[model samples]
Target: MLRRRLGVARTLKDFQGQIYGLNNLGTLLLQTGNNQAAAQSLVEALEIARSVNNEEAEGLTLSNLGLVEFARGNYFDAIKQYKAAIVLRRRFRDPLGEANTRNNLGDAYLAANLPEDAAIAYGLALQLARTTSDTPNQFRAFRGLFNSYTEAGNYPPAFRALNQHIALAKEEKDLFQELIWLRLSAQLYTITGDLANARSFYEQAIALARVLEDTGEEALLQNDLAQILYQ
Candidate 1:
């Protein structure tokens, strides 16, 4: 249906419609893991956006392209595209777009083993997300910070980041994510020899899992809680 609309839009010389169609198709393709097709669609959309002087559309398309490259393990290329998108987003004064691109850039940096750079990008993303009241991006930025700090062996900061993520997850009412974060917090506390916190979080996670009827997760958390108690 999207392709048909794109074809009709193209024939009618409807640049805006064509761009929208292309972006939609690209996003769908990307979500479905069709990197090559997604990239092609996004590239065409980007060209149209540029020709039409649509900075917002251009930034969005570039971000999609970055995602395609990132999924293909081309971290450098993804970073390049993300930087381009960030530039356009900043120019347009779009805080949410800027935050999203920055988060993507952080992920690319992490994938490239540049933990410090990832942390910097994530910091900016987090600030931008907060400024825009973009909770989802804020969560992503926190997750990125956690991963970057962990990679850099910054244990305390990593734990702080994880706590922030868990807090946000709870705010969003994402029980599954909250459960996962609680489990991770328990493990982190255990690793750092904070047995009291570890036991508390583990028991909390187990109780939550039991309430959710997640038998597997409850059993796992119970086992971890028992191990910590024995230690």
Candidate 2:
């Protein structure tokens, strides 16, 4: 269908339709792990967007291109593409797009082993996501911060971010995810020698696991709790 649209759009010389068709196709390909094909389609879309001054298409294409680069392990190139996309998204007054692009930039930074930079990008993404009431992206930003800070050994802020992430999981009523985050929080606290908090989080996770009927998680959490208690 997308290929047919691309064909029709090209025949009609409808630059906008061509851009949209190409971007959609590229995004679909990217999602399916066809990075090379995705990049080809996106590059063509980007060229057409630039030639026609289609700012929105250009921005969307750039973001898709960033995903391609990230998938290919070209972190620096991915960061560059995301930054360009973010600037265009911001200029077009698309806060949601900008926020999502920033989150992508955070992931690229993390991939490049730049935890501090990733933290900064995630912080900006969180603020933008909150402004737009994008709860999912807000959750994602916190998750990124949790990973960034934990990797950097910044335990206090990492724990704080993990707590917020878990709270958002509760808000979304995703009990299984909440249990996962709670167990991770317990581990983080344990790493920091905060046995009381570790035990508390572990207990909370155990209770939640029981509620969810996840016997395996419950058993694991109980064992972890026992180990910490022994220490």
Candidate 3:
């Protein structure tokens, strides 16, 4: 309806509007696990954003690029894109955008085996979330921090961050958030040689993932569980 009402002529003239459509399309494909299509659409969005010198749009497109890289397990490339997105978002004074990109940057760094760098990014993301009063991002940042610290071998900070994330997820009544946090906490515990706690959280995560019908999350947790069992 919006596109029809706007008309092709007017929409084409509005670069932002055109990019918006591309952005939505790309995001939809990304959600459906179509990395190639998502990357194509995201690149188109990036071109439009660059043409208009729209900082916000550029940041969004870069973030989307990071997602594509992550899907392909190109963690270093993902980190670069996410960092670029964060810089653009910060320059635009878009706290929410900065927070999101920071979270993605942290994830990319962690995937690249740079946990200390990931912790720094997650810390910045947490600060941005607090500044913006974005509860969801705050929760996400906490979880990111937890994982980063755990991977960095900073057990105390990791435990603290995990507890904070779990508390926030409970307050938000976000079962999915809780489930992910549980899985992460479980892995941390397993790494620290706390098998009993690891098993407990793994069971909780598996149960919640099953209920949500999230095959991706289920598979990830299964792999983690298998590793824990192996040890």
Candidate 4:
């Protein structure tokens, strides 16, 4: 049915409608694990976008192609596509697009085992997200930074990025998520030899666990907190 509509749009030479349909169908195909079909649709969309000189549409199609390549484990290909999209996004003055593409580029860099590059990309994404007041993307950028730093064995920076994520997440007031982040914060602090901070986080998690009536988690946190205090 969707393809039929796309066919109609194509036959009518409805450039805008056709491109939108193709991009949407491509995304749906990717979600369903039909990478080949997704790529085909996206390729057609890219051709149409380029032919029509629609940089924004071209950038979007390129970004979708990046995801297809990433899913296929072609990190370099994904990076190429995302970089292309970023250039177009920047040229078009699309902060949101640039932020998203930069984040995707970070993921590609990370997948390519280039944590430093990933960190750089994620840092840029974070700044862009912050500038645009895009809270969700800011959270995503911070999460990516945390992972990138962790992968690079840079514990302090990783902890800082993760701490920012926790701060932002606290606004959501998801108790279970809070408990999890507190536990992770404690672990990261322990790794960094920040015993006092570790103890504080562990204590926080323990109290939350008690509130949630999670006796097992409470016991674990208490034991960990005790060990930290003994230090």
Task: Look at candidate 4 and give me any clashing residue pairs.
Answer: none
lDDT for 194 (candidate 3): 94
TM-score (C-alpha, index-matched) for candidate 3: 0.78
* TM-score, per-candidate, Cα-based: 0.86, 0.85, 0.78, 0.80
Least accurate stretch of 10 residues (summed lDDT) in model 2? 171-180
Identify the runs in model 4 with alpha carbons over 4 angstroms from their true place: 172-180, 183-231
Best by lDDT: 2
Computed on alpha carbons, the lDDT of every model, listed in order, comes to 0.91, 0.92, 0.86, 0.89
For model 4 the local lDDT of residue 163 reads 76
What's the true lDDT of residue 23 in model 3? Answer: 76
TM-score of 4: 0.80
The sequence of per-residue lDDT tens digits that candidate 4 reaches over residues 62-120 is 99999999999999999999999999999999999899999999999999999999999
What is the TM-score (0 to 1) of candidate 1? 0.86
How do the residues 9-113 of candidate 3 rate in per-residue lDDT, one tens digit apiece?
A: 255687888777777777878889999998998898899789888989999899989999998999999988998897898888999888988988988888999
| Ranking of predictions according to lDDT | 2, 1, 4, 3
Score candidate 2 by TM-score against the native. 0.85
Q: Which has the greatest TM-score?
A: 1
Q: List the residue pairs that clash in candidate 3.
A: none
Better of 1 and 3 by lDDT: 1
Candidate 3 — number of clashing residue pairs? 0
Between 3 and 4, whose TM-score is larger? 4
Note the clash tally of each candidate: 0, 0, 0, 0
In model 1, what is the error at residue 175, expressed in angstroms? 3.9
